[model samples]
Target: MIEYFDRGAIVTSSLCAEVMKKMRNEIRKKRQGKLEKVLLFHQDNASAHRSAIAVAAIRDAGFEILKHSPYSLSLAPSNFFLFPRLKENVKEQRFEDNAAVVAAVQEFLGAQDEEFFKKIILSYKKFILKVYYNKCDYVEK
Candidate 1:
């Protein structure tokens, strides 16, 4: 999961192109060379980050594209749970704008509890909704 300084203008999801590029680069870095031919592949949506150019770069690097869901949270668990809490924790610190905010955000994220991150994911997946017998309320998926 990745986030930008702000957000992106182009893309299906809100993920910034730079952040996605960085993520792809990081994955490629794990490969010694011939990154376009690596065995491990990532599933990503058709966002700006997953643009045709990005797909070509990824394929050129050597990774297979796994089948992913339309909802990004299914692919990016950190975005669905952990990272938003990090952003919130930073916001709660009440730091001044500019470098301070950035610093606070970084510090909070760096200090996040591993267990909490795990718990958020677990909780998100485990949540169950209540059903009332009154109106036709539930959408059967």
Candidate 2:
């Protein structure tokens, strides 16, 4: 699921809730019969991400939140994989404005194939195992 907020828009709990609803619908539509009954949703413990309303929205959408250890920012899959790829794609390219930046990000994200996402998922699993083995200590990325 790919989405961008409007320029200067604040990402409050309400906005995150709405985005999650939209993303859930998109995922459901795309997966159709293949959609699982239980969805494991992952996100960092940002204030907006952990807000009561956001949690309620996620539960309402039938997702089970995957918990992360406190202060385990490095364990975030996007930090290890997704954003790095995005930064690489947009690197050295000049955008006219916020919309252009958003468009560039969308284009880069859209270009990624299923194999790329599969690889990230595998890497995430490996990272989780590594963290478990290391007693939940922050492992080097």
Candidate 3:
């Protein structure tokens, strides 16, 4: 699930579309013969993420896009799970360049075991249920 951008490259809608294609390929390979399982793709409502190109790419890959509602920001897996750990890991670390930053992030991510990812997913599920029961209102941490 790691995709790196070039030094000066921006993450445009086209880039996101390309990434969706790659992700689809990876998922297909992982599932192998389990083609009946639906792919539920969750992404924040960033401009690139909501772009027509990105939407079309997701549809082309047979993924069901999960809407990222504003009220659900607290329920976002990246916000509640990934980014906090990532920020802590990189905090106060000096990097000479973008590549160094990327390398550091990769190292931090590589150090996480399968249990870490599983825990994040489980936490996300719990948060989602909380949001549902709260009638889509912002949940207290």
Candidate 4:
């Protein structure tokens, strides 16, 4: 599920669509071809993500795009959880190249278990509840 982009490469609508297709295939394989549960896909409101082609691709992938407000860090689990943990692990470390950096990231992600991912989902749920209780106001960190 880790996708590496080339340095300075722009994320176009086509690229986003392609990645969504790949993600769909990966999710299908993970679910053993039986997706009984609805797939709610979330991404920031980047231009590429909102483009017509990207929206079509997401629909084709059988994923429902979760509504997200612009600049909403409180709703982004990766910002509060995943990336912070990743940064903690890789901080003060020097990698020989992009491959080395990628290897390190792969190692960190691979080390996480189902419980870790479950906790992430749980945290996201909590965040959603907080947002709801706050009447769609800015969620506290």
Candidate 4: global Cα-lDDT?
Answer: 0.84
Top candidate, metric TM-score? 4
Candidate 2 residue pairs that clash = none
* Candidates ranked, most accurate by TM-score first: 4, 2, 3, 1
Per-residue lDDT tens digits for candidate 4, residues 37-96, read: 778887766789899999999999999877775546556667776888899999999988
lDDT of 1 by residue, 1-141 (tens): 434453334554334334446666776676556554445444435465477766665565455665444433344445546557777675546655556866766677677789866787566444212111213243222
User: Could you tell me the C-alpha RMSD of candidate 1 in Å?
Assistant: 7.8
| Candidate 3 residue runs with Cα over 4 Å from true position | 6-8
Model 3 scores what on Cα lDDT? 0.83
Model 1 misplaced regions, further than 4 Å: 1-46, 71-74, 112-141
lDDT of each: 0.52, 0.83, 0.83, 0.84
lDDT of 2 at 96: 90
- Which residue pairs in candidate 4 have backbone atoms (N, alpha carbon, C) closer than 3 angstroms, thus clashing? none
lDDT per residue as tens, model 2, 1-141: 767667777889998899889988998899987985799888877899899999999999889987776757876678877888889878899989888998888788788899999998999888888777877777765
Residue-pair clashes, model 1: 7
Q: Return the lDDT, model 2, position 108.
A: 81
Please state every model's RMSD to the true fold in angstroms. Answer: 7.8, 1.8, 2.0, 1.7
